[model samples]
Target: MAVRQVIFAALGVSVLALGACSGDGDPILMHAGAQNRGPDEFAILPTKPLELPDDLAALPAPNPGGANRVDPQPRADVARALGGNPAAAVSPGAMDGGIVNYASRFGRNADIRAQLAAEDLAHRQRNRGRLLERVFAVNVYHSAYEHMWLDKYSELERWRRAGARTPSAPPRELLDN
Candidate 1:
């Protein structure tokens, strides 16, 4: 009886040792869902080969038929309205009289020009103040009022000083466009 029990214990110990050793040497069986079924399901499709042209440098020049075409009649009408002759309007270096040429005409001591600039500045300030008031009125928050106030007065003062240093002049080449 004792010998049979010893043999049974030895057999059980050897079986457990063999299972541990087998587990250590065996590769893990990965459950990759449907990917591990077979190569027939996961095989890549063959790509079609591309054929190149024999003469690569024989391309034809671009056609200009689709380019925009301009009509001279409307341009001539516009030039006529701007004080140029409609028939002889196609000449180069023609004076259309569309430009005022203030820099050439008005000296630095021109009272009318200075008065016009001051009036324009006053108009701009009134419009800007009204706009700022409307914007702040839309929002009931007091912080918006403070921000608008600073923007209108302080920023406008800075811009006015900058403008005084470099007084605004009309753009050159007014008739070209």
Candidate 2:
């Protein structure tokens, strides 16, 4: 009876050890919810409207590498829509001095974008799922970030209870859906 009890205890301990080895906690996903799909439809831009030239011989020589007269100029279009000089869109220095000053008030890091991209890649790789999850190519991004998920309605209620005003927040009843 004593020998049998010892065997059972050892078996239980081994089972727990195996279970612990099954995974590292909080699995991350490499691409989040990204799916393999066709090219984005919004990326295709329409060419500028066609217009007949005043003189056939007066037309400038075509340079494939250079900007075309009929090329879509979205910045110019936006400037025109806002009743500003369309030509201003071509000049980098045409931006308002006050706006530029305010935007650069905090010191800028030129390589910040590259640094962030590298750091994000490292984080995803470091937390990239368990052995079985990685082997089966399972997505665990949402589950991994579950702690960061916000319940907006509950948060608003808590804030209101604490006497904080939320003028633009929707009613709690509307947030049920």
Candidate 3:
């Protein structure tokens, strides 16, 4: 009975050890909810439209560690906790009861990613990589953003735009062409 109990404990310990080695050795993503990007809340300093009173003596007594009244209300609860009426403090245009202005961008970029992807595909097609560029891959992207100094394609494009004119058609381009 003692031997059996000892064997069971040894088996359990070995199983737990094997479980630890099962990982792929990659860093475990802690903040998967944020797509591993972590929090961006502290990225930019939050500002409010509110201004302080000019009269230094008329100002309210400052607490030991009170939040600034001039600070933007990040949320309705925060505004309420700071002793400010959210309904009155928030502007008429402010949605979500005077929280962050992030709500104003709601539905604004619904199809923007898809549209940008399509545009990217078109841009890549228009500027297809050569054999050397295909090997490197970086040069293709580098040329995409660079200025048209000594452009080889512009000359080719100029030929495509130059059509067979019927009886002296001197091109007056830009909308009239």
Which model scores highest in TM-score? 2
- List model 3 lDDT by residue over 1-177, tens digit each: 999999999999898667655544224342121235555787776676677679978988878777777665566556788897775665446545445356655645668799999997898778867865554332355466455446644544565578634333333463244
Which is the better candidate, 2 or 3, if ranked by lDDT? 2
Candidate 1: worst-modelled 10 consecutive residues by lDDT: 24-33
Structural RMSD, model 3:
19.5
TM-score for all models, in order of appearance: 0.18, 0.52, 0.25
Query: How far out, in Å, is residue 58 in model 1?
Result: 19
All models: lDDT? 0.51, 0.77, 0.61
TM-score of 2: 0.52
lDDT of 2 by residue, 49-157 (tens): 8899999999888877997778888889899999999887865565576677788899777898999999867866877889877765566666666677898878898
Order the candidate numbers by TM-score, best to worst.
2, 3, 1
Error of 1 at 150 (Å): 33
**Which portions of model 3 show Cα errors greater than 4 Å?**
1-73, 77-83, 86-113, 128-130, 147-177
CA error at residue 61 for candidate 2, angstroms: 4.9
* Consecutive 10-residue window with the lowest summed lDDT within model 3: 25-34
Candidate 1: C-alpha lDDT:
0.51
